[model samples]
Target: MRIGILTSGGDCPGLNAVIRGAVLNGIKSHDFSFVGFRDGWRGVKEGDIFELPRHQVRGIAKQGGTILGTSRTNPFDGENGGPERIQATLDRLGVDAVIAIGGEGTLAGAKRLTDAGLKIVGVPKTIDNDLDATDYTFGFDTANQIAVEAIDRLRTTGESHHRCMVAEVMGRDVGWIALHAGMASGAHAILIPEVPTSMEQIFGWVREAHDRGRAPLVVVSEGFVPEGADAAFSSRGVDSFGRPRLGGIGEVLAPLIEENTGIETRATVLGHIQRGGVPTAFDRVLATRLGMAAVESVAARQWGTMVSLHGTQIHRVPLRAALDNLKRVPAERYAEARILFG
Candidate 1:
């Protein structure tokens, strides 16, 4: 069988590992030929691709980013897009099935195309860990580790200067990254979108930490909004998916904390750093397993399905079931972490 693969949405640490896993397993076990779409859905719409033999994907398990590259292009847009055009392109190229590795937007597109009779499988990919279908996604662990390391570094500088340091980590609609990183790094306070905190409450935490002869370390998710605010702070813009480009909450919170608590403060945005670099051992293994399972799904002719991690095992689930609702941080989980708050 001639199978096509594409990596979509924001680049993450375990992307290359997924490509390696799928290609190796497809070639070795199933004797299947593989090709990679160059830049997400755009490549598929334009029929731009390259051959993927065993040699092309060798030694890329620990590598960060993707060998096939990625983009935020919606497969339903443009004149050459939609399921009809995509299917025509696939027919011309003799591609039998597609394995899409990406976050929500990418999988949604795949689901739509599959409903139109396309053979496609999905592998969930998001550092936010917001997809409810899978117990855990691949890039979350690596991103959490990166955020924790950044907070640890910020702590030493904050102590030296006797200032409150606010670290912003990426979490658009969920606070998994910020919550795990803050708890792991021993942050004095952790702010997340699931819990809307008042500035007064944040100031109180900072003041309390300072009074205890400690440098206050605040970790916040990018999507976190103050209690009175109607939305998360976002002035940058929106992406192709029409979701607001969320960030700069740390920048907004830094001055407020300093002014309210009379303590010097600084903000550090750990932007794309969390998305790059070698993946953690946990992420590498998980991504690899998910990728191999995706190939198995393709062999089984499971269209409109996604490979998900259910506890220790990888299972295939319907695309509709996976995209039904975003997995959010439960209030109980946030409350448990709140116990460590200053």
Candidate 2:
């Protein structure tokens, strides 16, 4: 069998591990040939690809990002794009199945192609841990670790200067990263998109922490909007996929926090840094397992299914099930996080 793989959306650690795992497992166990799509779905539409033999995947398990490259390009765009053209392109390449590794958008497109009669499998890839179909996604651990380290470093500086520090991590529509990182860092205040916090509440937390002789540490998701702040306040602009470039929420909150609490404040946006560098051991193993499971699903003809981590096992579920509800930080989890807050 000839299988093609593509990684789309934001780049994250452990992506290369997935590619390596799939190629090695498929070639060694199933006698499968592999090819990789360049720069996400645009490669599929434009017929841009390269051979992905088992030998080529050597020594890449610890590598960050993907060997196949990635982009936010929608597969349904352009003159030569869409299910029909993509089907023709795959047929021309003699590809039998496609494994799409990405976050929400990429998997949604893969689902569409499957409905259009193209054989496709999905692997969830989000640092946010937003997809509910799995216990956790591959990149979340690496990102959470990076965010916690940043907050820890910032905490010390805030202590020395007697200031309130606001550290923003990625979470465009949810607060999983900020929630975990903040709880892990013992942040005084944790703000996320799911919970709209008022400046009044933020000031209360900062003041209490200050009174307790602790540097006020605040963690906020990039998508978090303070109560009464306009939704457009966080928009930096949109990307090629029309997804807004989320930022400035931490910066905006810093001054408000300072003015309300009479304490000096600073903002640190932990932007792309959280998504880069070496993946944690957990991520590498999980991504590899998911990659292998994806190929297994393909061998079973489980089209439209995504390989997911449920408890200790790698399982398969419909792509729609994962997309139906994004796994946001629930109220209970946020409440537990608040137990650490002032």
Candidate 3:
């Protein structure tokens, strides 16, 4: 059988690893030929593709980003889009099935195509770890490690300058990255989207840390909003998915903390750095396993399903399960982390 693969949405650390895993497993175990779609759904809609052989995937497991490239293009929007056109393109290319590796938006599109009788499988890929059906996703571990390291460095500089440091990490709708990184890096305070915090509370933490002869280190998710705010801070517009582009919350918090507590403060937005570079060992293994399972799902003709990590094992579930609800940080978990706050 011949299969097509594409990686979509924002690029993540373990994307190349997933491609390598699928191509190698499908070729070796299933004797399947592979083709790659370039730049996510746009490639599928426009019929842009290239051949994938064993050698093309060799030595890419540790690499960051994706070999097939990616984009935010919605598959249902455009002149030559939707299931009918996509199916025709697949038939013309002689592809039997598709394995889409990406976050929520990409998988939703795959589900729609599958509902229209297309043969497609999904592999969950997100650094936010927000998909509800899986215990964890591949890129989250790598992104967490990157955020922790950056926060650790920021702590030292903050101590040297006797200033309060605020580090912003990426978390659009969930706070997994900020929660884990802040805890690991010994941050005095952690602000997340799940819990709205008042400026008085944040200023109290900063002042308390300073009174103890310590430089206050604050870690915040990009989606965090102050208690009285109408919404998360977002200067940039929405993406193709119609979701608001979230950021600059840490910048908004920095000045407030300095002004309220009379402490010098600086803000550092980690930005895309968390999405780049080699993936961690944990992410590499998880991504590889998910990719391999995706090929197996294709072999089984499991349309509209996605490979997910439940506990220590890989399993397949309906794509709708993953899209049902976003896995959010529980209040108990946030409370446990809050116990260590200044």
Candidate 4:
């Protein structure tokens, strides 16, 4: 059988491991031929692809990012015939199934393609770890570890200069990264997009920390917005996939916090750094498991389903189920994180 694979949305650690795992297993065990889509959905739409073989995937397990490349191109954003075009491209390539690895937008696009009679299997890939079906995505643990280490380094610098340090990590409309890393590093304050905190309340937290003679370390997700502060930072621009760009909240919030409180402040946007570099051992194992499960799902003809990590086993979940609601940091989880707050 012939299969296709593509990675989409933001680049994350362990992507290459997933590609390698799927190709290696499919080729060795099932004698399946695989082709990779270049630059995400655009590659599928434009017919840009390359063959995947065992030798091509050698020694890529520890590597970060993806060999298949990725993009934010949403085929359905403008054209009505996008699905038809995709079908034509599949026919030309003679692929029997497609394995799509990405976050929400990519899965949504996959769902549309499946409805249009394409055989698609999904594997969740979000640095935020916000997909509900899986307990965790491959990249989330790596990102959280990176952020925690950064916070640990920033703590010493913040204490030496007696300043408030705000470290920004990626999370759009969810706070899984922020909550986990903050709890892990014992951050003074953890801010997320789910619960908007007032500047006055935030100032009080900072001041209280200052009074206790502790240098404050605040971990804020890039998607976090201050309460009633939409006038300052509006989501108005389109990304490559036509999704609204969600960033810059940390830079905006830092200045506001510094001005409100008398504490000297600095903002460090972790940005793409957390998504790059070698995958941790944990990520490597999880990604390999997910990849093997995805291949099995294809073999079983489980279209419109995603391979998810539930407890110790990789389970199959409906694609729509994972995309229906974002797995935001719940109130209880936030409360646990708050216990570590200064």
Q: Model 1 over residues 1-342: C-alpha lDDT tens digits?
A: 999999999999898889989999999999999999999999999999999999999899999999898999999999989999999999999999999999999999999999999999999999999998899999999999999888999999999999999999999889999999999999889999888999889999999999999999999999998999999999988877778999999999999999999899999999999999999999999999998999999999999999999999999999988799999999999899988888
Q: Report lDDT (CA) for all predictions.
A: 0.94, 0.91, 0.94, 0.87
Error of 2 at 15 (Å): 0.6
Q: What's the C-alpha lDDT at position 157 in model 3?
A: 92
lDDT of 4 by residue, 15-88 (tens): 98998889988988899989999988888888789999888889998998898899888867545237787888
Candidate 2: list runs displaced more than 4 Å: none
Can you list the residue pairs that collide in candidate 3? none
Estimate TM-scores for all models: 0.99, 0.98, 0.99, 0.95
lDDT of 1: 0.94
Between prediction 2 and prediction 4, the one with superior TM-score is 2
Give Cα distance to truth, residue 275, candidate 1, Å: 0.2
Query: Per-residue lDDT for 170-283 in model 2, tens only?
Result: 998899999889989999999999988888988999999999999999999998988886672545678887767788888988998888789999999999999999999999
lDDT, candidate 3, 1-342, per-residue tens: 999999999999998888888999999999999999999999999999999999999899999999899999999988889999999999999999999999999999999999999999999999999998999999999999999988889999999999999999999989999999999998889999999999899999999999999999999999998899999999899877778998898899999899989999999999999999999999999999998999999988898999999999999999999999999999999999999998
> By lDDT, is 3 or 4 better?
3
Clashing pairs in 2: 130-327
